[model samples]
Each structure stands twice: as C-alpha cells, then as structure tokens.
Target: MKFLHSADWQLGKPFGRFDPDVRGALTEARFDAIDALGRAAAEHGAQHVIVAGDIFDTEGPEDRTIVQAISRMDRHACSWWLLPGNHDFARNGGLWDRVRQRAGDKIAILSEPEPRELEEQIWLLPAPLIHRHNLEDPTTLFEAMETPGARLRIGIAHGSIRDFGSSGETKNQIAPDRARLSNLDYLALGDWHGTLKVDARTWYSGTPETDRFQRDEPGGALVVEVHPDIAPTVTPIRTGRFQWLNRDWTVNDKAAFDAECDELLAKVDAPNTLLQLSLAGITSLGDRVAMLARLENDLGHRLRHLAVRPDDLVGRPREEDLAALSVEGMLGTAATKLNAKIDAGGPDGVIAKRALERLFVEYSREEQA
Candidate 1:
C-alpha cells in the first residue's frame, strides 16, 4: 500500500517575530500547505494519508481555522486519519467535536491508543495525546498491542524520541526502538519540526511548511510504500512555498561585502522568504555606514523580512576613513580619541566605536540631503 505521512500542521500560529506583511504571508502559508498536501496525495497516488499529530497550533484555535482545515482535507477524497497531538490534544473535546461536525465522515480522528484496520491488509495503532505534556512514553503500549494476522501494523505517535529534542531529560519520550518492539512494519512520528529517521522503521514527518530558518530538514511529507513481506520504504517530498534562510558571513573588505550583498539581493526571486543575516569581521567606518544605508534604502523593503545582527561587526576608522569624514578642530580631536579607544579594545572601546559610526552616519546622511 502507498501512503503519505505528515504532521505538525500547527494552524493559526501567529508569526509575530516578522513584520506585518511577512507575518500574514507565513500564516497563510500554513493553510496553503494544506491545499498542497491534498494535491500531493492525489499526485503521488497515495491510497491513504496519516497526520501523526499536532493538527492545530493550539487546543482552542479559532472556529474559522478548524472549519477551513476540514474544508481543505475534504479535497483529498482519500482515507485520512488525524491523531490528536500535544497542540490539539483531546483535553478539549469541544474542538474535536466541531472538527468532526465540519469534517463529517471524511476525516477520522484518532483520539485513543487503539488498532484501526484501514483495510484487510493494513492496520494502524495510534497513540493520541490527551495532554500537552506527559512524563511517560506515549508509545509504550505499542509494544503490547497486537494486530490481526497477515496485516501491516503501523504505529502513529507524537513526542520526543529518546536521545533527541532534549539534553537527556525530556518529557513525553518515545522509545527509540518502539517499532522493533511493537513488531510493526513502520512507525510514523511527530513533535520534532524536522524530518528525522530513528532506525529503519521509525521516522518523523516534520512540518510541511517552513516556519523557522534553523530547521535544516526540508519541509515536506513522506511517501511510504509497504508490502506484506518487504520493509517499508519512505521518501521525503518538498511542500513548502517559501524558503527560510540563515546566512552568516564575515566581511573583511569593502569589495567582498558589496559583492556578497549583491549576490544575496540577486537571489530574491520571491517576496515570501525569511532571512536572518549575521555579519562579522572588521571594515572601515565609511564602508559600514554605506552598507547600512544600502540595506535600509535598497534591500530591506524588497524582501519579506531581513534581520541583520551586527554585534560582532566592528567599525575601525581608518586614516582614509577619517580623512573622508572631513571634521575639523575639536570634532577631529574627539574622533582621534575615539579611534584610540577602539584600538585599545575594551567595553569602552565598543562604546567609542559605535559613537564614531553614528557620527559618520549622521554626517553622511546630512551630506546626501
């Protein structure tokens, strides 16, 4: 049987870290991913689709979000199973009731740990979370759960796997080898926001849409093929609309810095991307000011969001930089003092360097005006 495995839809999550426009686009992308999931299910010829857990961002999402989710799932027109995750656990029965009312008989919600026979050959044992947090392993029952003869047993669960998602002290843990002990053909997991494989039989289908730049795993679903005798094979498919990037660069010279910025700008084909840029290395005060001006005027507004972390970006006023500033008398003397302080290298040096950079920026802006 061919099936699609996915999880962590996390609908109605507010992307508050980004600007208003970017936030709206990100939130919409979550919904957009649902549409894409249905299309993918049809395109990949998946007979069934299973969402491991965390169907909603919160237990009590807006009613409209629930309605829209049901509406999107209706398009798939295949056997769809949703296991309640920590984010939308069965603690809130009313939310699931609303979902069931809207979903009708199309989508089945797995709210308990029980074996569900999808067909004569396929059986699913789902461990649905009823609380946001738990001290014991949710999938422990899978070890003792029995399936009918000549059936492909699959375990569906949501939580942190052993040796993952914590520093050896995580709650809601799943045994790393749950699939082997359960004697199952495959184990589909959720909770980790990245596609991960634990042993050959256990796998995590990360969030379909890319929300943060840190998760290096490609955002998508897993297409799994299972037969009566052979081990199930899984393939990751991309389903995200926007790309999340984290670029860290060290600019030691002006020409290299300009080229880097130009290259980054040239790659902006879409307006729904998120970029977190961290810049370091030493450069002249004048060049730093010019770079900031270019970013503020030329590149900032064009992208969905741009965050520049400049804590390690040092501003060294070179002799040529000081000459370009064209200050005289007391101002020139103060600039020299600041430069010496920067050369000394201490907390005061950082303050002095920032003050000099501001002076240069103000003067340059005034000249431009």
Candidate 2:
C-alpha cells in the first residue's frame, strides 16, 4: 500500500511579527503548500493519506482556511486518516468537531484510542490527544493489542518518543519501547517538527511546512510504501514553498563584511525566502551602519523578512575614534565596553548580545542630542 505521511500543517497561522504585507503573503503560502501535498498524493496514486497531527494552529480557524483544507482533501478522493496532535485536541467544541461536521463521511478523525481497519489487509492504530496534555505513554493501549492478522499493521499517533532524548514538559509521550512492542510494521508519528527516525520501524514525519527558524533538519514530509511481507520504504519529500535561512557571517574588515553580505544574499531567491542574518566578529561603527543600510535596501524587497545582528562589530575599537567624537558619558562608555567584549575572542557566545550593545550606543547618542 502506498501512502503519504504528513503532519503539523499549522493552517491559518498569523505571522504577526512580520510586516503586514509579508505576513499576508506567508499565510497564503501555507495554503499553497497544502494544495501541493494533495496533488502529490493523487499523482503518486496513494491509497490513503495519513496526517499525524496539528492540522490547524488554533481551535478556531478562519472560515476560509477551514474551507480550503476540506476542499483540498476532497480533491484526492481517497481515505484521509487524520489524528489530532496537541494543537488540535479533540476536546468538546474544538476545531476537530467543526471539521468532522464539515468533512461528513469522507474524513476519518481518530478521536479515541482504537484500531481502525482501513481495508482487509490494512489496519490503522490511532492514538489521539483527548486532553491538552497526556503525560503517560498513549501507545501503551496498543502494545497489548494482539497483532491483527492483517497484511499491514500501521500505527498513527502524535507525540514525543521518549528514548530519542526529547526533553520537555511534553504530554502524550510515546516511548520507543512501545513502538517495538506493538509489533506494528510501521509507526507514523508527529509533534516533533523535524524529520527523525526512532528505529527502523518508527518514524516522525515532521511538519510538511515549517513555521520557525530551526535549521536543525530539512523540513518536509514522508512518502511511505509498504508491501505485505517486506520492510516499508519511507522517502522524505520536500514540500515547503519558502526557505528559512539562518547564517552567521564574521566581519573582520570592510571588504569581508561586504563579501559576506553578498554571499548571504546569494542564498536567497528573493521574494521567496524568510531570512534571519546574524553578523558577528568585530567591525567599526561606520562599517556596521553601512552594512545594515546596504542589506536593508538591497534585500528588503526580495526577502519576506530580514533580521540584522550588529553587536559583533565592536572588535578592537579605535579609542581615538570615540575620543574625537563630540559625544560623551554613557554613549562613549557603551562603545568602549562593546569594543572590549568583541576583542575578548568570544565570537560564538551570543551574536545578539553585541547587537543589543550597538543598539544602546546608537540610541544613547540620539537621546543626548
């Protein structure tokens, strides 16, 4: 059986931190990504599609967001097994209830702990989030289920796998041992936003499209193909429309800063990326402002968002430069301290720390006038 495994769609999300126009664009991009997923499932001839969890960012999604999601799923005309993660828990009056009402008979929402038979040979063991948080292992119930005499025993759930070293106040934690004990051929998981493999048989498909700045792993979905007696082959498929690039560039000289900015700009396809640029190391105040202005002017239109870090520009400050300035008191002290820190050979500690210092110095100068 061929199936598309995906999770954490986070539909109807508001990028409030971004500019109004850019935020609107990001919201639209999410729907576009979902449309792409549905098309891919149809093209691949998938018998069913499994969404581990987090179908929506909130319980009350906009009417348009909800309509678009249902329309896309209907387009596939195949079984859609959707399990609720922490984001979309199946509480009374929750988004799941509304979706179930709208979805009618086509969408199968697993709101309880039970095994659903998709076909004679295929069975889906669904473990859903009943409450906001379930500290105990939710998969324990399935561990005792006598392996159904089916061609495939697939486990679908949304939680953290304990043995994988995931630490937090996580609810509905699924231990690695449970997956092995359940005797299922494939365990499809979600909650973790990065694609991870717990064992040969268990996998976290991650979010189809990412909403954060984490660059730990490539964000995408998984396509799993299973045969009756053979091991399932899972392939990671990239489905994100926008690229989130986090880069650290050290500026030891004017030429180096300019070159690094050029290199960082090259990675962006412009008007298609969400970029966070962190500049570290030491540079002169004049060079720092110039770099920030240049980046803002040249790449602002091309990027969905841009964040500049200028704290590391204080390496080996020329004290004579500050002495020559008409400014005095706190402003001069801040400049001197910033230079000392940058000269202390801790380029990797915190890029934002230096950026903050530079901000204070700039603000102090303006206030004193």
Candidate 3:
C-alpha cells in the first residue's frame, strides 16, 4: 500500500514575531504546502494519506482556515486519516468538530484511541490527544491489541521519543521502545518537526512545512510504500514554500558587515524566503545604522521576512565618541551608563540594557526637536 505521511501543518497560526505583511504570507504559505502535499499524493497514486498529528495550530481555527484545509483534503478523493496532536486536541467545540462539519465523508477524523481497518490488509492505529496534555503512554493501548492475521499494522501518534534528546523536558513523551513492542510494520510520529528514523520500523515524518527558525534539522515529510512481507521504503519530500534561515553575523567593520549581508542575501531565494539576521560582535553606531538602512531599503523588497537583532553586539565606547554625540544631560549620561552596564553585565544582562538604551534614544530624539 502506498501512503503519504506528514504532520505539523500549524494552520491559522499568528506569526506575530514577523512583520505584519510577511506574517500573513507565512501563514498563507502553510495552506499552499498542504495543497502541494495533496498534489504529491495524487501523483504518487497513494491509497491513503496519514497525518500523524498537529493538523492545526489551534483547536479552534478560523472558519476560513477550516474551509481551506477541507478543500485541500477534498482535492484527492483518496482516504485521508487525521490524528490530533497537542496543538489541536479533541476538546469541546474544537477543530475536530469543524472538520467533521466540513469534510465528514472525505476524511476520517481519528480523534480517539482506536484502530480502523482501511483495506483488507491495512489497519490504521491512531493515538489522538484527548486533552492538551496526555500523561499516559498512548501507544501502550496498541501494544495490548491482538495482531490481525495477514494484515499490515500501521501505528500513528504525535509525541517525543524517549531516547531522542532532541527536546529537553517537553511534554508528549513517547517511549522509543513502543514501535518494537507494538510490532507494527510502520510507526509514523510527529511533534519533533524534523524527519528522523528512530528505528528501521519507526520514523518521524516531521512537519510538512517549516514554521520556526530552529537550526536543529530541515523540515519535511515522509512517503512510505509498503508491501506485505517486504521492507517498507520511506522517502523524504520537501513541501515548505519558504526557506527559514537563522545565522549570527559578527560585525566588527564595514567590510565584515557587507560580506555577512551578502552571504545572507545569497542564501535567500528572494521573494520566497524568510530570514532572521542576528548581528553579533562590536561595531560603530555609524556602521550599524548604515547596515540597517541597507537591509531595510535594498533587500526589503527582495525578502519576504527580515528582522534586525543587534542584541549580541558588545564593545567599549570611546569617551570622545560620546562627546561628539551633541546630546546633553540625562540622555547622554543614560546612554553611556547603559553601554557600560551592557559590557559589564555580559550577554544575559543585554536585554535589560537594551531597554534602557531605547529610553535613552527616545530622550535624545525628543531633546533634538
């Protein structure tokens, strides 16, 4: 049986951290990625598509978001199995009901711990979230179930693997030994947001689209082709529209800053990429302003998302530099004091120092008027 496995769609999520326009595009791009998944399934002649979990970002998505999701699932008439993750649990008046109201027949809402037989030799065991947090091991139920004769047991769930220290002290912990214990042919997992192979039989399909600027591993889905008594082959498929790049650029001079900017701009596919540039190291205010202006004016239209983070820059300010600032009284004093505090306090104290620096900037601007 040929099946498409994917997870972590995160639809209707508010990308508030990004610029308003870019956030909108990023949210919409999720649906486009889902559409691409449906197209891939149709092209591959998949009998069923299994979404391990996290179909939506929230339990209560906007009506339009629900409509868009249903439309994409309907595009392929093949059976689509959806399991709810921690993000979209089966709470009262949740997205599951909305999905039922829209794509009832076309999709199977596996929002409970149950196994449904899809074909003569295919059984889908879904471990869905009853609440936002499930302390018990959901896979334990599947382990107790009697194996069907001449059938392919496929287990689906969303949680963290025990042995995989990818995330620390996070909820939804899945025992790594579950796949071996359950003796399932294929175990599709979610929540890690990266394609991983726990074992030959167990695998994490990961998020179909990229959402955050995590530098752990690239995000994508898995396509599994299973034949009875034969080893199931899994392939990674890239579905994300935008490439999320997170890099620390150490700027000590104009040449270094320019080179770093060039490197970042080169990474972008332009108009289709989201970039988070974190500036580090010491540089003059003149160089900082020049780089910021260049990024805002020159490459602003080329990139979909751009953010300037100067929190990491640290250096001792020359007294002569402060004297030539033309600011007087508390504003200048605060700027000098804040810079000193930032340098002495180290990286952990930079955020508080930045707050004081902003106040100083505001005071200086008001005094000039």
Among these predicted structures, which one has the highest lDDT? 1
lDDT of 2 by residue, 255-330 (tens): 8977876776676666767778777776655566567777878776667788877555553334555663426576
* After superposition, candidate 1 runs with Cα above 4 Å error: 163-170, 216-218, 265-268, 325-327
TM-score of 3: 0.82
TM-scores of all models?
0.94, 0.83, 0.82
Pairs with backbone N, CA or C atoms under 3 Å apart (clashes), candidate 2: 134-172, 271-302, 283-313, 311-354, 311-355
Better candidate number, 2 or 3, judged by lDDT:
3
On residues 201-268, what C-alpha lDDT tens digit does candidate 1 reach at each position? 88988889977777544469899988766788899998887777888889877788889888977875
Predictions ranked by TM-score, top down? 1, 2, 3
Off by over 4 Å in 3: 91-94, 163-170, 216-219, 314-369
Q: All models: lDDT?
A: 0.81, 0.74, 0.76
lDDT of 3 by residue, 1-369 (tens): 888889888889898887788888888888887777888887888878899888888888889998998887787667789999888887657678878987857699888787888788578888888877678877888976654663699999888786446452127778787867887888898887778898887898877778777742445778898776666899988777777777778888668878877876676577877677787877655455566668899876678877768667643334644664436666567666667666677664576455554553454466569
RMSD for each of the candidates: 2.1, 5.2, 4.7
